[model samples]
Target: MQFLQFFLCITVLLLYCNVSRSAFLCELNQANPFKVALTSTVDIAGKGNFTTIQSAVDSIPSGNTKWIRIQIFAGVYREKVTITYDKTCIFLDGAGSRETFIEWDGHERTNTSATFTSYAENLVVKGIGFKNTYNLGPKQNDLVPALAAEILGDKAAFYNCSFFGVQDTLWDVGGRHYFYQCYIQGGADFIFGKGQSFYEQSVLYYSLETYGQGTYIGYITAQGRDSADDPSGFVFKDCVILGKGKAYLGRAWKAFSRVIIANSKLSDIVVPVGWDAWQFVGHEDQLTYAEEDNSGPGADTSKRVPWQKKLSEGVKGNGHVKFKCPTFLKFKVKAMAVTLSDDEVSDNESDKTGLGFVKSIFVPETHSPNFVPSSKPPVSEIVKQAEVTPPRKIRVDL
Candidate 1:
């Protein structure tokens, strides 16, 4: 009888352990079971690899060459997230901008203002919403500038994301960055910094009641290129600038500030005098504020400030200006090539849908050796594969 009881107890313990392990694997492999074989991937849900985005980020080994993908499930993560310089090749994949949001309240003066700050190289952030919830005012005087995201990383790309704040919504602080199909909301000098950045097919929203009140006066950019030799500038191409108040295209944050808004749609909210001098005097000639092929009610250049350049005839807008680094151009070429090729395919696949465009940014149909697809796999095959494969090296902070 004693021997029989011992055997039964051992069997029950083994069964319990197996079930627990299977459950853990199922949750970790919720999106893609074979993702473990492709690249280092981590899933962050309420009950997954790690509860918070920061915890998942912290677990990543520094100076990593392989891309580490952090797939965040739908939730409001109220935390100040930062990707340090040592953590390179990190891909942040969120469920969707509307579903996954990372928010915090910080300001420029306090040095803790940015809700999302990245200082890593080759970082990709997609389908997420980054917000700075610092309130700005009371209809009369008080105003504060907070940053939603500060991208100080080289070759960083943000796709299908949303940045929300009152002032300084996006600080393109340094390096070469690209914002594609992203929504940025702000008021005073919202898109600022000394970065060679491009905003393509993105929405720049100027909120009326968000910043300092009374009259609706807002400025979109304040590019801080200190010298003419600096290869830093902002290019807004095929973007939509629409919002509730009057705004200037940009102001001279530095003497040789450079900005170009080309082939974009501007709403009537854009002021006729579309550029400002700010406090800089006698720097008009040195500044490079230009507009080309822009349309809509606000694109009338006749009333624009005389200092702002109207690109004439064959001269392309800022064509000679090159990015400070080489990797940025390479990344841009790769992205454009992928997009163009995908457009040629005629199959009505799920990845070709409107929502699929957003998904494609982070989860490519086929991945490079360094990347992993974040799509669901066949259940039967995945289970078999999981059974044979060794357990993934993931730290679960339960």
Candidate 2:
């Protein structure tokens, strides 16, 4: 049966190899960067390796390092799924968000209530929809924590997927992650946590469905970093936030919490006071909730919180400082006189994450010489320079 399926796969690929694409074969010990050499299929029908997603996941050995592809066919699977910690290097492929999904009705226990939870490293999930239907059912108005997905692993990414719930929709617990062109929806604190993540071109739908617990207003994020050295932040670059009721962009969930909404579109659903200090009233100067180059009715910051002042604080660098826009958790050099280097932030041990690479980075040209792209100082070098010229450290709150 395995040989017959392999023959059929080869026949199908040979018939559909494209001009700008190349066909990949499943081979062991091969050197292809896209190393999807083994496949485990999951389908509601009895036409694949496993009939259920959990059984397919159970087949993978612990500490597995190869790129194992689990292709899920078109269906709405009504089961709670979890990729365990030992099952690393998985590529979950689905038909489409509208055509394929996994959901459950787990209502209590925020730590274990997710319909889909991934705790593995080097994982890539695409085209799947995770929904916790507890609040969407008969208890639609319950202000409870129903998480669609909780990501707590390193070097994981999601693309073209959807996460749905009422509150705490995505628990980006910790790690470095990237979400590209995905859709996330919830009522309060929908997208929260301390993960160092880059959300690029994603869509946020804030449904003010069950918001009446704390302050009567909804909060889009509850991100909280531990300290100045904590490498955890949520950077939403070039995204869209749309909804009905008035909501603050985020509130300080911790003392040194950090969130940046940059180059995004905000509808009138956003409140005039953009952010809330929550319990961090005395430590407002410690947290960082910044907005850059946003537009639309809600983007009007005339009535925003005084702490979040306009960038009219003025520029202090060499005219303009530029960093590469987000692209799949990657960074590039801009070739400017004093631009950051194309440093690889993947699998690094430093507490400073990719966004941290830009924190307090710009040193006035008067303090230093003209730095070409290759000669740009590393993030650590700036700290050493601070020891020399303490006044030259221009702190950026990203």
Candidate maximizing TM-score: 2
Can you write out model 2's per-residue Cα lDDT over 1-398, one digit (the tens) per residue?
Answer: 00101111111111112112221211223443334557789998888898888888889988775668899998989998999998876778888766678989887799999998888866777778889888864464566898999999866778667888878999999876778767787878889898877786676767755455334678899996866556577877667776556788998888877777767778787889899999989767666676767877888888877776222212213322132332321222111111111221111223232223222111122211111112233323332332244211211001
RMSD of each: 19.1, 16.6
Clashing pairs in 1: 106-113, 107-113
lDDT of 1 by residue, 340-387 (tens): 011221112222222110000122223221332233322222223323
Instruction: Tell me which residue pairs clash in candidate 2.
Output: none
lDDT of 1: 0.62
| Candidate 2 residue runs with Cα over 4 Å from true position | 1-34, 137-141, 210-215, 309-398
